[model samples]
Target: MFTLIYITASSVDESASIGRKLVEERLAACVNIIPSIRSIYHWEGSMEEDEESALIVKTSHELTPQIIKRVRELHSYDNPCIISIPITGGSRDYLEWLDDEVKRP
Candidate 1:
């Protein structure tokens, strides 16, 4: 029941802070932070574009809810982007390592 959680933050520092909290709290096995990314979307009936940071979190499916909740608490956006994707396939060893790193719910 592995999963990858994708989250967008206003800046690298914010993303890093959230990532660090997740890892420290044992809610995530690993987190990859993309320092800079351009995002274009509609907000409040207007097209908006901005530079943001992306965070990829690796952990168990059971932890997704808590991860989402935690991210919301730390996020700045009124509606932060936090989505989870199931890990249907991957290297067995790495997956096992992921399981080992994150606490089982």
Candidate 2:
């Protein structure tokens, strides 16, 4: 099983930090950082908007728990968004590489 995890960060530095940790620990095969983006949503009983960095994390389903734990440990937000979506289809070679990169110990 594979998943593309979506996470929002306060800045590029934080995004890099999160991505680095996940890759270093082999929790994610890869992490793509979108440096700047506008975000709008409800928070603390009110709607808010801000500029944020987005992290697109790629990993196997088996490592989600560890990934979530590590992300929360490093994240600045009291409640950061960490959502996962199933990867139903993808290139065989790329998917194989992903599997090899995030193999469970």
User: Which residue pairs in model 2 clash with each other?
Assistant: none
Cα deviation at 10, candidate 1, in Å, is: 0.3
Q: Which numbered prediction scores highest in lDDT against the true structure?
A: 1
Put down candidate 2 lDDT per residue, 12-74, tens digits, no spaces: 999999999999989999999999989999988999999999999999988888889889999
User: Which candidate number maximizes TM-score?
Assistant: 1
**Candidate 1, poorest ten consecutive residues by summed lDDT:** 70-79
lDDT of 1 at 86: 92
Model 1 lDDT per residue over 1-105, tens place: 899999999999999999999999999999999999999999889999999999999999999999989899988987899999999999999999999999878
lDDT of 1: 0.95
lDDT agreement with native, every candidate: 0.95, 0.94
